[model samples]
Target: MLHSLDADLAVIDPEYQLRRAARVDNELIYLTRTGGGGARFARRIRRAREEVRTVCGVCGRPGIPRTRSRTVLCDLHWHPLTAVEKAFALSADIPEAWFTDEAEIKNDAYVARSAADQRKESANHLSERDMADLLGVTVQRVHEMFEQELLAGANHDGRVVYPRWQVMEGGRLLPHLPVVLRAADGIEARTLQAIMENVDEDLEGATPAQWLAHGGCVEPVLQTLDQWWWI
Candidate 1:
């Protein structure tokens, strides 16, 4: 026998055992009771596991439970040392265990290395193409970044739109950068394409989000303004 779905588009069997469920907006208004809640619970657990699989930004690996604490370290790159470990490290007699777990030393090195890289990258001036190249997303996507108001920009009608200086000034609230950069530079399509190529030369392959996150160009723009407050 065939069964018809409701106007709400909820599917269910003859017994209404919740075979399906749906949500509108934030509300779960439709539920089909075909089998049982066990199936739903199982699905929920699967989703939870998938969510946990996300990698931590600091460590570049899947998040995992750590021996130092009960809290899972799947996404936490900097695992705070326990009081015992802290005291041991600070003590005149350092524990040999601290040296044995090369992982702890590795974390410190990661932080130092990342900081140095950031400093070096921040010193460089970004051309239009340099900005475009690293962000693997298209020029249109770059424009969307501006539309989203992530970055402030100044109009250069006859010229290129440039990002506003405020984006990186005094380490202030960094708005979404595209809007600001586009406005400041009044950039054209070709200039953006050039940027993409320049970035590819250095990064090999990079995503738009990665380019934005690197945040070197923004800081330099702000620093340049320090000389001329007349604007």
Candidate 2:
């Protein structure tokens, strides 16, 4: 699908690599990528424009469409930000021509949103409660792991404070979140601790490679738990 943009010169291939080029005309510009159903895709997207009265980007709420250039985000869930606001947040300057077209605007929005998500993720240091939620276990289990040296955490205000890295590291120890061990309702806190301790003990004699082998299931397990609404 991407080849079409290059064929049309809609993308610049400065290095002779088939890259989609940005197109500008009059007061409008667009970022084009090849995606369509023959000649039918454009028709469908156009029909969507007419038929889709409103789409809220954040909470998925329905609302009236406002055609202002920067007003693309669903008003209910997202605060519309000016291009300057985006530039400041991303620490990058955006070209003025890019804002002239709806498609380019959408692409810029995507890039800005991704940067925001990355910033949030980097700052999200998990607490004990966060780890408990991630593991589908109890706060007590985190404490137990600490006591057994299978997990490392700090004591803050007499409460166990777990950093996000610790949870990710612990996920390395047990790839899957403890959904099965959690039972239909939930596993007792002590039971969770004992299970982790046992798992850690079993791998004590194993190599780092063996540790990594078991760790690959973490993402899949997270997916399964999310599917089950266990996470």
Candidate 3:
């Protein structure tokens, strides 16, 4: 059994508690994230949009639309922002073009992939609870890794699942996964797997995962990702 302090940690972790609550009450999750209630949420959103239009959400640097970013984030703050809101949060001045969440990612010069077959890729999968155990980390860390896209996973049925291949001996993630995962933020796991496994022209021969496994630099992969248009 965990020590008393360890036992108390899960209840205290907002992500763990939120996960538990989400299993029971999705509406509660939505309400909590939106800051509660319909009218108040709308007001909060309106106020947020207004603030972002004038200043950089990251630094408060002031600039106008198009003069800064075609989107809400200013040019300096605009390096490879993903739709993962926690990873990149800004309420206002988000590009009208980029609205509907990373649709603009498609419209931008970025990586592109072909249609992925959505078969159930659930073999050797680990649950959130199981992965935490495997990594010997706190549940919160597991959530952070997944949310930050340092871990690759996909939704299977209604639940999220991570493939066993990403975890190596001693529970370490594959080399350079964090950097690669950052580029693949919105990609489906199968598509990402395909991209990583295939021998590509970019590397001049080796697959991306193989490239990294053999100690290749990550810059070339990032360049491909920079202009990646998601399929």
Candidate 4:
């Protein structure tokens, strides 16, 4: 019976074939035939259509195909700046044709979003007095720590503001705060803040601040910073 069905299917679809017959319990049985040639081609076309019709990665809405790789993105998330904008934003010379590469555009989008997130996080800053109170030390002691490079801060609107992540509850700094500060010495405060806030793949997706908070080793973190030329 299976042979009869297989012969009929082969005649109807020239690209289709069936094989692999076996005997089981003295009964003739056939192995499931794989989808080949025309059937497989049809399946691939269907899958490509599905991929093109999938939802956007950034938003839940249905996406329009945006790249040769068929990445789907909505209008809001599909915004790619021109080469001039990219060059200005990245402070580097970039060719207009560079944006034609989908990978480069995706990377630029990721970097832009990361920078925006870091900027938002950095807005939560602590003044010297606030830092001193949080650490249970005098304001002058906070200044001394900054001068000694034991802590880091940035000037905001004529007032110095420290990143709140540097200090923990119960008047203690992060366990590896000094080590990170020393390694990150001479790097700008904004860059250092971004490094601390960004998730490190080596640390299993934990931010530097979270890793140190949970008693992670500092050597690995320092090594990562060193590789980035931050040390």
Worst 10 residues of 3 by lDDT: 22-31
Model 3 residue 210 CA deviation (Å) reads: 2.2
- The alpha-carbon deviation from the true structure for residue 148 of candidate 2, after best TM-score superposition, in angstroms, is 1.3
Tens-place lDDT digits, model 1, residues 1-231: 012223212232233333223221111222232333345433543443343334332343465434221122333345566778667665856444543457566666755554554443333333234334544556566456556655333233233342323223333434444443454353333233223222231233542223444563544333222211110
Steric collisions counted per model = 42, 4, 11, 0
Question: Residue 52 of candidate 1: its Cα lDDT?
Answer: 38
Best to worst by TM-score, what's the order? 4, 3, 1, 2
> TM-score for every candidate vs. truth?
0.24, 0.22, 0.42, 0.47
Residues 1-231, model 2: lDDT tens digits: 124423433223222222112111101111222322234433433334432335433223464433322223354225445767756644654344433466455645754664564445334445777777778778889768756555545443356654343344445433333332333234223222222222232245432223435464343323222222110
Model 1 C-alpha RMSD vs. true structure (Å) is 19.7
Residue 53 in candidate 4 has what lDDT? 58
| Total backbone clashes of candidate 4, pairs 3 or more residues apart or in separate chains | 0
Give the best candidate by TM-score: 4
Model 1 Cα shift for residue 126 (angstroms): 8.0
lDDT of 3 by residue, 1-231 (tens): 113322333333323211111100001111112212245433443443444456543344664443211233355345555567623445565544444445445524221111111122344568888899999988788878888788887766577788776776677777878878877776657556655655656787877666776678988877655543222
Ranking by lDDT: 4, 3, 2, 1
Error of 1 at 73 (Å): 9.2
Which parts of model 2 have CA positions greater than 4 angstroms off? 1-124, 169-231
Error of 4 at 164 (Å): 1.2
Residue-level lDDT of model 4, residues 73-123, one tens digit each, is: 655456777656667745664344445567556655744554554455445
TM-score of 2: 0.22
Task: List per-prediction Cα lDDT, in the order shown.
Answer: 0.37, 0.39, 0.52, 0.61
